[model samples]
Structures are given as structure tokens and as C-alpha cells.
Target: MSDIQPRRSYVPPAVRATSEWSWRLLLIVAGVLAAAVALQTVSEIVVPLAIAVLLAAMLAPITQRLARVMPAGAAAGLTVLGTILLVSGLFTLVGTQFSNGFSDLTTQVATGIEQVRDWVRTTFRITDSQFDAYFDQIKDSVGKSGNLGDTATAVGLTATHFVAGIFIALFSLFFFLYDGPHIWGWVTGLFPRAARARVASSGAIAWEQLSAFVRATIIVALVDAVGIASGAAILKVPFAFAIGVLVFILAFIPIVGALLSGSVAVLLALVAHGPGVALIMLAVVVGVQQLEAHVLQPFLLGRAVSVHPLAVILAIAAGSILAGIVGALTAVPLAAVVNAVGKHLFAGESKGEIEQELEENADKDPLARR
Candidate 1:
């Protein structure tokens, strides 16, 4: 009876398929986690290189035009220099404005603080002793967090890291602008000969997507800056120019940037004038944001990048969690590039069909042709 053997259990096809998928899914997740760990481990180099790539994408068209007349190396250098100068000029302007107006602004803020304290005292019945006790508690909590020496050491290390990152970014940007095609070719060469063409095609799609994202973001950011700055001016808010500059810079980071800069403007108005003016300033900020969200972003960025708002939000959140402000600033563009490359690689189109579509798109967009 034992020698005859029991019949083997028959597994359903659905169960078999599930078993196959379960391990593959686990492997995929494991690979992703491994890659993330590796990236984080070398983030000092990786982050700067990533920034260079983005800067290269944004400056590529300009570099190309410059290259037509000058050498590629020279063009890249000049482009980088120009970018540095532009940023420096903006900083100088903001600094000058802030310096000129800071004293008056501080006076206004001090008076406003007194008014706010009086209101709080009257409304909440919080006495001076209670306020002092609250402040002392806050100070004690902060003191317990770390000593002055530890805090200074952290600041020094951060500054050193920042400076190193700047140099790395600049060096990489030069090479990326001057030898982008050669670098990309070398990267593809790492793959098998049969897959090199496919890799190159995907890269092209990714570059196009990145370029489009950069262009659209610039326009959207400009519109936001102008809209908010104009509102501040119309409301006669103090430091309107500073607010505009700050907003323009912050607008580079999606979603959160505009909200933060707008809040600053609102706070300034409140401190300089009163709640009445601050309320109007807030309405203006909200109106401008509505226009940006509904009109400019949808019309410009939606068409150019073709990424969903939900995806953008999620990317920003993940990036912020992973890499802080730099991560948030870069998250959308990275997502756009990945989305485009993934679609091209996995769209199931034949080689000829893909080439034909790319050709058609190139004809429409001069930048894509390159």
C-alpha cells in the first residue's frame, strides 16, 4: 500500500501564478531597498551629481546655442559663470534691500509684538509671570536637546558639506554640458550591444522630459513671483521687492515653497500694518495661488511634463523625507524623467514605431531634435 504511493496534490493554476509572483515581488522590493541604501550611503557625491544633471538639463539649450559659435568647453564654462553671476546678483539685491529696510521693519515688528502681547493678555488672561514661565520651559527644553559645542560642531560640518557639494556640482555640470552625448554613449555601452540602442532611446526620452519639466517650471515660478509681488505692491506691503525675490527663489520648490513665501509676506504685512491689511494680503496670496494652481500649472506644466498632481505631491513628500530641501527641489524633475523613460522602455512598441514617433516629436520640438 505504501509502495503504491498516495496521489500527489494538484495545485490550481491561480495558486501557482500567485506563488510565482509573490517571490518576484519580494525580490523587486529587496532590490529597491538595497539601491536606496546604496544611494544614501554615497549621498554626498550622489546629491551633487544629481544637481549637476538637473542644471545641465536646464542649461543645455543655452549651451547648445553657445556651442554653435564657441567651443563646447568654453560654452559650458560661460554658462556656468553666467548662472553664478545671476545668482550672486540676486543675493546682492536681496541683501541690500533687507539691510536698508531691516531697522524700520524691526521697529514695526516690536510695536506689533507689544500689541499682540496686550491682546493675548487681555483675551487669555495670561500674566507676565505665566509668559515668563512658558518661555523658561521652552529655553530649558532647547537646552536639554544639545550643548552649544555640539550645535556648533553640527553647523561646521554642515557648512563643510555644503561647500564641497557646491564644488562637485560645478565640476560635474561642466562635464555634463560639454560632453553629454559622449557620457551618455559611454553609459549605454555598459549594457549589452543588443540593448544599447534601446537604452539610448530611453535616455533621449528622459532628457526631453527633463528639459520640458525645467522649462515649464521656470515659467510657472515666474508667474507666481510676479503675481504675488504685484499683490504685495498693490497692498503697499513693506519689503515688497524682498518678498518678490524670496517668493521667486522659493517657487523653485513645488507646492510647499509658494506657501512658505506667501506666509512670510502675510506676516510682514501684519507686523507692518495690522490685521486688516494682513487679511487683504492673505486674500491676494490665495487668489494668486488659485490662479497658479488652476491656470498656469495646468496649462503649462501639465502639458509639458504630463505628470499628475498626485504624483508630484507624493514625490515631493518622499524626497523631503529622504533628503530634505534639496530632495524636495529635485523630486518632481526626477519623477518626470523616470516616468518618461519607463514609458518608452516598457510601452511594448516595436523599434520602428518608436523611432517614427520620436522623429515626429523631434520635428515639433527643436530641443528634442538635439
Candidate 2:
């Protein structure tokens, strides 16, 4: 008793937690900021590689199957060739149709605009002066924009960047499909010998998660596209198939993407069909999206990624802020895979157990090529 100091509660539980998490949260933010800076610094190289990785993950099962039937290199080449052809065909079809029908579409749109104007004037009792004032405001805003030459230069640069990104993605896709295992093995080899197995296991788990996420997303997208497109077709909407394709592609971007694509379809319908058809299209969009949000996504992606909705929203927001469209597209899958791998490692699962779990996952994988 003589030697012991009087016991005292110097730390309040609330204060202690606040202090403890404050520093940890700060550190996490700092680390994330540093990583973001580094990524932006090497965006050109990183963007293509990241896209290739996701595409490679999507095509991995097919690649593996094709490899068994043929040489790995030839299989990868063929897969890449097929993807290129598919994309080119889509673009060609869209461009040709757009070019051929643009003038007619423009005329129809002009007529639709007049109809809208007349309806607005009649419904709201708006005068010519009010309409002219609004139109003048729009004209003033457009007139204040940059010169045509600057716009053309900007467009040219954008097109050049697009072409370069495409080439890089394609080149990386072939190598990733053909030599991804070897590349990953080499990467793991760089780690200390004892840690290599854990690293390899974690990577395998991440890949499985990636594959599962992509495949489930693809399926859900197809379902949404079909559902919405069928409704549009029943409404006898023009370019229904094209709108379906657009919806399918945009559905990759998650919540916002599908909504925007559906809105586009609705607008087109309103212009080409009428208010009744547009209303029907609107109901179709809402119904399909609700089904996706309530049923397919939760069942499929929940099983695959196990990410909370809040986490998905946060990831998408952070990704869009960090890397715009590409980031938004990749964010959810990346977060899910990282979450899976981190949870696996942090749970102290042994490398042996990881391999077993991964094998089980692969066996049950929906997209696994039989």
C-alpha cells in the first residue's frame, strides 16, 4: 500500500475512443490521399491496366477453357479479337444508323419542340415575350462560351486520348489473359518466401470475388436491358434495340447509369411516340429498376461481394471524385475484392484454408467454364 499510487480514472471512455479513432481516421485519410495522388500521377498507364484487369477477370473462365482446347497465347488472341470485333461492330452499327437518320430525327425533334412550346403557351398562358426572354437567356449563355477553334482542338485531343486508351487496353488484355498467372506468380515471388503463399492466396480470393461480381453484374444488366427494351418494343418505340444496348452498357455504372439510360429512352419515346407511350416507358423503367434494386442485385451481388449498400454508395462516390467515369465503373468491384481479401487475411485464415475456400468458390462459380 505504501509503494502503490492511488488509482485514478484519467481517461474517460468517450474521450478515449474519440482520441483513439481520431488519429486512426486521420492516418487512413492521409494514406488514401497519398495513394490517390500517386494514382493520378500515373493515370494514363494505370487506367488502361485497371480496365484490362477487370476485362481479363470477366473473360478469365473463357480464356482458361480456350487454353485447354488450344495454346494459351492463341486463345487469348482469339478472345481479344472477338471482343474487338464485337465492340467495333456495335460502334459501326450505331454510327451508321445515327448518320443515316440524324436529319430526319432532327426534323422530328424540331416538330416535337414546337408541339411542346404550343402546349406550354396554351397550358400556362405564357406570352411570346416570356418565351423570347428565356430563349434570349439561352442564347446569351451559349454566346459566352469559348471559340469554335478551341472547341475543335479540345475534341481532337479527347479523340486522340480515346484511341490511345483503347489500344493500351487491348494490348494489356491479351497479355493479361495469356500470362496473368505467370505475372502474378512473379509478383508474389518478390515478397519474402514465407509470405508468398499468403499473398498468392489473397490474390486468388480477390480474383474469385472479381469474377463473381462481374458475372453477376452482367447477368443483372442483361435482365434489366431486356425488361426495359421489351416494354419499349411493346410501346412501339423507335430504336428500341439501340436503346436497349445503351441501357445494357450504361448499366455497368450502377444506380445512376441505368436511370440516365432509361431517361434517354423515355425522352426518345416522348419525341417519337406520345405522352401515353412515354408514361408507359416511365413505368417500365421504374418497374425494371425496382426489380433490379430489390431482387437481382441483392441476391446476386450480395452473395458475390457481400458489400453493404452504404459501402457501395461511398465507393462509387469516392471513385468518381478520384477518377471520374473509369473510377465509378471499377469502384464497387475493387472495393468488394479488397474487402474480401482483407477480411480473409485479417481473420487469420491460413493459406491452406484459403486455397480450399477458393477452390470451393471456383467450383460453384456461375461463370466458370465447364
- TM for every model, in the order presented, reads 0.90, 0.87
Query: Model 1, residue 120: displacement in angstroms?
Result: 4.7
Residue-wise C-alpha lDDT for candidate 1, range 45-79, written one tens digit per residue: 98899899888878988988998999989999999
User: Per-residue lDDT for 120 in model 1?
Assistant: 75
Residue lDDT tens for model 2, 1-370: 4998889969988999999999999999999899999998877778888899989988877887898889989999999998889888987887776777778777767766666677778989998899999999999999989899999999999788778988999999998888876777788789999887677677777888898888998999899889988988898676777787888887877877887899998998778755656888999999999999999989887765888768878998988888788988998889899898888789987777866765665443423212
List lDDT for all candidates, in order.
0.83, 0.83
Worst 10 residues of 2 by lDDT: 361-370
Model 1 residue runs over 4 Å out of place are: 1-3, 10-13, 118-130, 236-238, 356-370
- Among the numbered candidates, top TM-score falls to 1
Q: How accurate is candidate 2 locally (lDDT)?
A: 0.83
Candidate 2 segments exceeding 4 Å error: 1-17, 122-125, 355-370
